[model samples]
Target: MKRSKSKICSNEHAKFIKQYKSKKLTILFCQLGLLILFICLWEILTQTQVLNVLIFSSPSRIVSTISTLYTSGDLFYHIGITLSETLIGFVLGVGLGTIVAILLWWNESLRKILDPYIVVLNSLPKIALGPIIIIWFGAGMQSIIVMCVLITIVITTLSMLNAFQSVSNTKILLLQSLGASKFTILRKLILPSSLPQFVSVLKIAVGMSWVGSIMGEYLISSAGLGYLIVYGSQVFQLDLVMSSTLILCVLASVMYLFVALLEKIVHRRLGL
Candidate 1:
């Protein structure tokens, strides 16, 4: 009887895996098809002058502009600079935000004291702080990183804190009744239970970090994709602007997909 039950479970699991793989392939193909269709339509419209090539810029023209930048050796430098700042800011913002959230979760009084300030900061426009950041850290990488950090940190902290707090009080109380220390309860129950929210916050932080980095570059930068956009607009080089914007979109999409991949890995490990 036990052997039969085990075999039944195995078959069910195999069937589920087959279905999952089929759905995944379907989604991937659909996404690729939609992107190709959009590009084709864009090129057609531009060729027909329905969309002005000078302003909207065709896919082919954007590709040509990207090639020009690559041949001139400016593409990688700008991308590298922006990429580095965004990544550093992302790491620091998420790290520090998580740490602060843990501390707040551990201390109720401290959480109460800081909660209002966190809300206010999260609601404030990060761009308004650009001039102040420049004053504090100067028109360099330091200022750019600071901008990214500021943008992501508050959101991260609040998100994580809420996740921690939302863990069942009954679970916490049951653990306490079992003589579990606060630290042990956190380690065994709270943190583990908060994994889903942690992944969610990371997804949010990924986009915030990019926005912060680009906005900072817009404010003051000798080099970076954001600088390219600003310069292209000023000189009416629409192709350059379109190309830079396209690259930005691609990079941001890549970052978001990376976070999504991480979410799947974490979910699987936690058996969610």
Candidate 2:
């Protein structure tokens, strides 16, 4: 009787897992179908002249332009330059932001002192600081990197700080009652609890990092997708503009997916 019951339970678990996997596959196929359908409609409209090819630019035209850039050896260089700036800025911004968050979390008085300033900086228009940044870092990669960091860091700090603070007080109190040191409480309790929030913030930061990098390129770059975009507009090559924009979307999507994959791995490792 006991063996039969155990076998029944095992079979039910297997059935549940099968259903879950099937659901995931369904969603994936649905997403792919939607994307393909949209692209087909877009191509049809442009080809039929319902959408002006010069203005809207068909998917085929964008692909052809990208192929041209690839053949000319400009595609990878522009992508590399922008990717390098974005990755560097993202790493520094997240690292420094995490450190600042830890410091603020550690010292309540310091957190209070910096909170208002952080809020003000977050609200301030970063684009207006373009001239100052150009003067300070020169009209080069340094300025572009600085722009990316500026866009990402404050947001990272605030998001992480809030995550740290939102950790349940009962958990901390229990650790305190057990005579755990402040460091121990933070290390064992707070940080662990904030992992999901950290991942969420990382996803947000990735998008902001791309925006900042592109904005900087627009202001001063001689190359990069952003530079391509600005030049394309000036030259009235709408195909070029659409191609660059498409590439940006693809790159941003890839980065977001990478972060999401990391999140899944971390959660699995942590058994969350």
Per residue, candidate 1 scores C-alpha lDDT tens digits across 1-272 of 33323333577887887787799999999999999999999999999999988888889999999999999999999999999999999999999999999999999999999888988898999999999999999999999999999998999999998999999999999999999999999999998899999999999999999999999999999899999999999888899999999999999999999889999999999888
Instruction: List candidate 2 stretches off by more than 4 Å.
Output: 1-30, 177-179
Q: Count backbone overlaps in model 2.
A: 0
Could you give candidate 2's per-residue lDDT for residues 173-243 as a string of tens digits? Answer: 99999999999998999888888889988999999999899999999999898999999999999999999
What C-alpha lDDT do the candidate models reach, one value each?
0.93, 0.93
Question: Candidate 1: deviation at residue 223, Å?
Answer: 1.1
**Model 2, residue 139: what's the lDDT?**
97
Candidate 2, run of 10 with poorest lDDT: 1-10
List CA RMSD, all candidates.
Answer: 4.9, 4.5
Let me know the TM-score candidate 2 reaches against the reference structure.
Answer: 0.86
